[model samples]
Target: MSNPKPLRKAVLPVAGLGTRFLPATKAMPKEMLPVVDRPLIQYAIDEAREAGIEEFCLITGRGKDSLIDYFDIAYELEDTLRERHKLDCLKALEPSFIEAGSLIAVRQQEPLGLGHAIWCARAFIGDDPFAILLPDDIVQAASGKGCLKQLADAYHETGGSVVAVTEVPREQTNRYGILDVGKDDGRLVEVKGLVEKPKPEDAPSNLSIIGRYVLTPEVMPYLSKLEKGAGGEVQLTDAMAKTIGEVPFHGLRYEGTRYDCGNKLGFLEAQVAFALERPDLADGVKTFLKKYIDKV
Candidate 1:
């Protein structure tokens, strides 16, 4: 039998200045921030792996070398683990999971916008469907599905654009891409149109866009024409909006809880919630939570 066409690549936009994080992000790429023990980007990569993405195009800038290094082989550390007979540690650091050749880091050069960052990986993406996973948004599913995978499954069947979405407070709809709903089952909602950060009262629907996206290559030209809006940057939401009626744009209500790690409060919440879920750290994290849960 002929092999099915592979979903060959994915673009991860990690070049953001992460200014929302202030002092801490001033020294680190927010993507490297840990949720429990794994870096935020690791979870993003893990999600891509779950969806069978073979190539990872990282749109990065200066001071982001640590992210690339973390996914590379640490010979000395592995050798030490081997010498000390720390089998579990050595296995945990296995190089196989890190696809060195499949990793391509291109310079974003400027923090123009999410669309610009995705454009930075144009060569890696080429002319095909590819997934975009934002590391700043850490998605967790008790149902064992990364939000992006849900979109991918939808894309696989429909061969069109799909985005992760959920209902946000109507007052805060301006902070997200608001979906104009057409038809709805329980899981997938047909998008009649899209709006980028519409004023609460102006919003057509309460559905807020999440970080997961499965887009076709045709969206690249639209992204290239993106004009700055909202934050003086070329918003991906604007680019996605351009595809409204032409593309089969739909919103997948992902069976997961998403955390915005770009903010301090959200990051802390993800760290605490993830720690409480880990078998090794749950007891300690729960105890610490009670100590500070009320007062802090």
Candidate 2:
């Protein structure tokens, strides 16, 4: 029998300085910020693992070592949990929750852009298909399939590039990399073209690329080209655009509610949504919000 293709690896770019959060991010890495109980980056890591991604490449910058340590062996913490007979909590602290050998961190060295950070992992990605997860964006779905996992499922069927996408307002198209959709299969839409922050008049469709992406190894060359675009930073959209006709690129309408945790409003919404979904806090949080809603 022919050898099966290797499972796709995931790359997460957590090297941003996160200047938006200001005082909070000054002392702690923004990706370390807790949405509820777990940190932001943890959600992304969990999502990737759930999708059967065996290896991960975290493109990190300075002041982000805490993220590495968070997933490392926390002996003292684990010991305390064990002594307290908190087996569940101790399990949460298990080292293999994020396998050490499976995860690698590479420094981006500069805040070039998303494309540059992804390129930094080229040596690690090693000419294979890979997934990119942006931790700043949190997604919640009733089903087990998170955004990245949803795309991975689609990739297996299509065997080409897949990006998680959703419809945004036509006027807001400039805020996203809008898609020029050619055909639709209800879930996966064939992408004929892509525009990065194009004016609404020029945008082909309102469908915008979300955070999750299952990309072909061919993207490495384009990302490596360091083609600077919007904000003088290397744009991933630009690279994906180059592969348009050559490779079959499709947009997946991920069935989930995506929260842009990088934004203040989105962060607040994520907190409420997560709180309401928690078995422990759901009732209390719902009661509190119902009472607070009237007063607000």
Task: Assess every candidate by TM-score.
Answer: 0.93, 0.95
**lDDT (C-alpha) at residue 171 in model 2:** 94
What is the clash count of model 1? 0
Best by TM-score: 2
Model 2 residue pairs with clashes = none
What is the Å distance of residue 66 in model 1 from its true position? 1.1
Q: Point out where model 2 deviates above 4 Å.
A: 1-4
Cα lDDT for residue 161, model 2? 89
lDDT agreement of model 2 with the native: 0.88
Give the per-residue lDDT of model 2 (tens digit) for 130-246: 999999899897576788888878888777889999999999998998999988989999998888999999989999998899998878899989989988999999999899877
Off by over 4 Å in 1: 1-6, 95-97, 294-296
**What is the per-residue lDDT of model 1 for residues 55-170, given as tens digits with 9 covering 90 to 100?**
88888999998888888888898888889999998776653357659898999998898888987777788887899998989888769877777777888766678889999999
Error of 1 at 240 (Å): 1.7
